[model samples]
Target: MAQTTELTIGYFTVIFDEHTGWTGGLLVLNRGGRPVEFQCTLPVRPSRAHEILFGTTLRDHLIGEVIGPILIKKCRTPLSMVCCDQAESLSLSASGGVPVALVGEAAENDEGPITNDMLVGASRVKLAGATLHVPIEHTETVEGIAGRFVDLVDAVEPFERIREAIKEAQSQISRAS
Candidate 1:
């Protein structure tokens, strides 16, 4: 099979409900923010024993280690970078072998630390609008990917789509049961 070099980005998020422990969805989009592929995992409700064993790290482990990789691996389209809203999901970078980042609003104080911020689009754009948290090693990769679509795609928009998709998926699952 021929390898595809299209610039694709993956957005991942997990929603947790009292009944459903964690339901994660990964939405793959082209540079223009068009949906390429989407994969959602079955709800994973960790047992009480597992929660006790994991302690405070339960969410990070469940979302990052367990759910995130499964969704990412199932994606048929090749992704250049994976963007997530949760810091816990940043761990997907290491496990999934793709540059992962946490997208959020930048800090108000410009004098603060810029060490971890991933600037999207033009350098002239206000830095306080959106920032991405990526591993130190993957900084360049994430920046390069973000730069390409900075003008075309809003960094925070795809996440909203993922959230809506998860809700839709959950409703379907609920209706079936």
Candidate 2:
């Protein structure tokens, strides 16, 4: 909801490019009313919480452009998911409790091991309403991982959370006014 009051939104997105490695990012939509934009680095991976966020500043190269795109391609297969959110601890059902690693789309069919470590990678990003919880996971094959990433795009929906948070933030801004 776009009101006079400003708001912010935290959204999770997965990107896939056959030519390059699959990458994901957390988006912060600043609706603060003032035109000032807010752009911050995502410190953690969404599916595999333990893994460090992609930290290279490649904003000037083709690979960098591939890393974050406005539109993402879709996939037809299922990818392993690790819920990463500082808001909640991850609890998987496998031994070692390591999150399930995701495979790429171009690889031969094989369901990777699911861990009790819970695919929950614990990284959080705050935006419009509430903090977006995300974890990161990667597979041996980039193709499989990219494919799984596509599945992620299809699954783990969070638009409603964003909308609610934006509304709440706007109300708070209005009150302040």
Candidate 3:
């Protein structure tokens, strides 16, 4: 049997509302940051096929369009018909407020199932088949990196814009690949 390599992929970013004191962030948890990595901020909008394929109502469509591509790209699979918005919201929270990592892999029937932990901390990621979701607490770090991000949020506007641009560039690169 041929061995399949696990791919570490995720989408992460920082968002800020200078006037409202609101901020959000996401980090796609992969093994490490890399040239083959995926992360970005794209204008996520709904498509007609989204409803039919995913069994999503108009309301659901509205929310999914905003973050669907991120999840799909990270998972390296087609979007699910029924999405757990709570999980998606958690992902956005990670994107805007703290560092969040969403991770996944395509499963081969010849191999095993994929879980959420594959993207975040190995101890925290939970996966069912090819679908995966990570817990918020998984952002915990022994080195206090997340704390720095939280403290730096206010000072991270320029860096955040750059991060967003990088994510866009990464997405473009994936499409090109």
lDDT of 1 by residue, 1-177 (tens): 223569988888887888776889888877777787888888899998998999888887988899998998778889898877776787787788898877655212224533334333312221114667667688777777777775544767776787788888888988998
What residue pairs clash in candidate 1, if any at all?
none
lDDT, candidate 2, 1-177, per-residue tens: 232222222332333333323334433333221212222222222233222343232211212233222211121112123222211112221322223222111111113433324335633332222223334432233223223232233222343343344445445755996
Full-model lDDT for every candidate: 0.73, 0.28, 0.34
Q: Which is the winner by TM-score between candidate 2 and candidate 3? A: 3
Candidate 1: C-alpha lDDT: 0.73
- Candidate 3 lDDT tens digits, 35-120: 23233344333355865777634333333335443444444322111112123333443333323333234221112454344334
Candidate 1 ranges beyond 4 A from true positions:
1-4, 106-129
Order of models, best lDDT first? 1, 3, 2
Best by lDDT: 1
Candidate 3 Cα RMSD after full superposition onto the native fold (Å): 14.8
Q: Please give the range of 10 consecutive residues that has the lowest summed lDDT in model 3.
A: 77-86
Candidate 1 vs candidate 3: which has greater TM-score?
1
Worst 10 residues of 2 by lDDT: 101-110
